[model samples]
Target: MAKINKRRKRIFNMLKSHPQGLNGEAISQQLGVSSRTIRSDIKALQDALGQYNIRIFSSPTKGYRFSQFEHLSSIEHELFKDNMSNLETSKQRINYILYKLLANTLNDISITQNDLAEEMYISLSTLKIHLNEVKNILKKYDLRVTQYKTKGIKISGEETKLRYCIVDIKNIHLENEFFQDLIMNIDTDLLDDIIKKVLSERKLQLTDRSQKKLCMYIAIAMQRSRNNKTVVYPSSLTNKIENTFEYNVAKEIIENIYNQLNVDLSCSEVYYITQCLLASKKLIDVSESINKKRVKNLVNIILKEIHEKLSIDFTNDEYLIDGLTLHLNIALTRIQFQMNIRNELLETIKNDYPLAFQMGVIAGKIVEQYDNIKINENEIGYIALHFGAALSRNGIKENIQAKNIIIVCSSGLGISVLLKAKVEEYFHNRLNVVKVLPGYEVNEKTLENIDYILSTVPLKNIASDKIIKINRMLQKEDVENIENKIFHKKDTDLMEITTFFN
Candidate 1:
């Protein structure tokens, strides 16, 4: 049970990041394993981690995550953190190649296959094999590898897609931690200030994340502009947004950028920047569309459907409705225009906020059915945030049923009283510390009708699921184990609680 493979170690970290949970197919895809292999790995993980109170929770479709507990200390952190960071796997190499190609494309640089293979310390044949996987991934972003074998390889895609793919790769591979420095020769600090000032003037409000993303997009724009890789918007696309408030804001932003960098940005950039603003989860839209009624209806339908599917009524949640309405309306425009904004936290949301992410997935399907357009995971992650917030706001408390428990403390009465106090304080009304008994008094007559026996010391011949052997001080693992065993979420309310002691 103590033994674990490197793959399972990666699985542990992946599950940690994705508290929502991941399905077998998803986990298998990330780890490059089969569903059968994943099943065995999960079983092994459950057995290995059970000692540490790291319970693996798995719903039929919601996926797998650490059940209720958030922290899992990796056993190999000191031994493998350094080795883990290096590009050891084929997946890592593919990611490296993707980044190199995109980075080169961003700066209009080129490198031959020979040099690329040499730099990575991989053979030409191995690099070629990895390139096949790299090409498949790029195809999803509407990007292609170009000029191979002759003038060296470059990423051939729309300017916006290039930027999107650059961010997308970082999210797909957690080890790709260097995307923040993708901006070069530009003062992002000054750019941030300018964006804030322009946004204030326009009375536009953005989340901190949105603002940061805009800064990066604008920086890329500046760098790309200098390289003559300017994005061009079609007349039809330009016509739709050219006169909007966001357009005006984007125009003001570029004007400030020009003043800061002394480089003239193309007219298309104004629309490009506006698209970024529209694609994000904004606090205020520059202009509210006349189709606001339709968006409200969609939000209502989504909440109603979620209630039906999850049996949680969010129809009366005005905050959730309003948030979804605004988000979906912009999402419609984003999908229609193919804006493809990056969601940095999609994997985390999908794994960690499993229920909410499933809700988002459900909501996304409804929108897809309505608009006849497919929504990506990034968009669904944004939708999940709304549901996740609603879940938190309305969750109020864990639905706990009162349980009968006897604290079998071999220590003195004071120590037993202290353990009882800790149990009462931590668990509140969830558990009943019926009586504190010495080890001698823990036999059948006292154990009769006792739902659980919490002991500081080991108890012999008592191997029931209800037996909780805890630390003397009730450490985190002890608390977690007790919680997992006794604190069940039932449909009953606090008012309906009936304790054995009472």
Candidate 2:
């Protein structure tokens, strides 16, 4: 099981309060995290709940709720189980060691075996065991760990590969004590204020998650610079970056950091930091500088591959072409700078849109061919979102059943029958009106296969969510409202991408 965090607990508590439940946006409001994070947390919580005879029920309309409230106490305990003990787990320790090694390498700090063991609260023998696991992880990234009796241990690899490995470490280990320690050492609030001020002054807006990531990249860069591990940007790239507004803004941000932290960074370090800033923020138009022939060929090949392999044609999608070209150009910039591109919606995109993700993988292969840089799953997910949006625009529909609705009316058979027919005429295959019954006749057993109840009369004992009151003769506005509910609804299982492959 994944480590349960405070956000997940708060989310569960909030959902527990509203048995009728809350949507992603509503839950996001109650908790200050983004909807994306809430969606991710919901999936993790769902997986964790299965063992407790509890389940997180979700739908486009209902958001999420626990299936069995009787198991709440047990579920809560399980979420908090092994809280302090989690750090001692072999997998957690391995992640911690990997994070320490990568972060120290970037900061050019060597860690002695004894110090490492002490930091991990493990004996030398146990530390060695975890070190072996760390080595295997490093090997996957084509990196090697070097240890010496005098100098301790450090990781070494190609510069770009090293950055990529650090990105991987950050993704896996950000919640651990090691990363928390790194954050605690810096005045992150001051850094955040300055970053916001600078971005506002420059009129460059980033989403909450993007802004958070930008601050993290800056913090990492600052930590490395403090340890005398300076970044050296290639001269060609440096010259190009120096001419951009992003580079200037990076300089300003660095200057603010120096003022706040009393640290000086080398010009190359500034240039490198500038690239990191640009990586997480919106891309400035590089249409004039991008290779038109290369991007055009890449798009044509991607569309062709999707057409031949999946029988999906998007040849006439000029808007797709324009949008994709811009995205590819930005992607190339990130590759050139060896910057990590994170897509928080990656899991959702992959889960909800399998064919789009497959097409994205094919496109990613073409991207890999054009540039030697291997695209990560996160980047591929972003590409998939583009294709998914394109598919939605072109009216390519998925035959997903929205719900199994039970209709209830207090009126006689004629009125109930008319209501059912109206609903069926409107919703069609999107929903199944499984049963029609008088309101007084309805009970818990009748709701067995039902997603929810559509009632002409108000339900007394039934949960608010179990019955949705509607007119016997539905108005045009009611039809539109139901249409919105059926069409724009997101699947409750936010982790549909992983589910698809599994």
lDDT of each: 0.73, 0.69
lDDT of 1 by residue, 169-278 (tens): 65455445545446667898999899988877776766554676678778888877778887777888888877556778888998998898676899888888888877
Summarize candidate 2's per-residue lDDT along 1-502 as a digit string, tens digits: 7545556767878888988878889988877778887888888778777777788888999888778786687657656653334564788788777777876775577989887775454679999988988899889778998975587998987655675566556756666665565544777788888887887677655544456666776766666666666665667888878766678788888888788778677787678766766565342243233576788778988888888888999878885776677667767777666676645556765676787789889889878876677998977876776676576555423325658888765432223444565676567567777766545446777777677788767766767555667875566776765654555434444456567885
TM-score of each: 0.56, 0.55
Query: In model 2, which regions exceed 4 Å deviation?
Result: 1-87, 99-123, 140-142, 149-151, 157-171, 243-245, 259-262, 281-297, 342-351, 368-376, 396-502
Residue 394 lDDT in model 2?
Answer: 57
lDDT of 1 at 411: 39
Scored by lDDT, the top model is 1
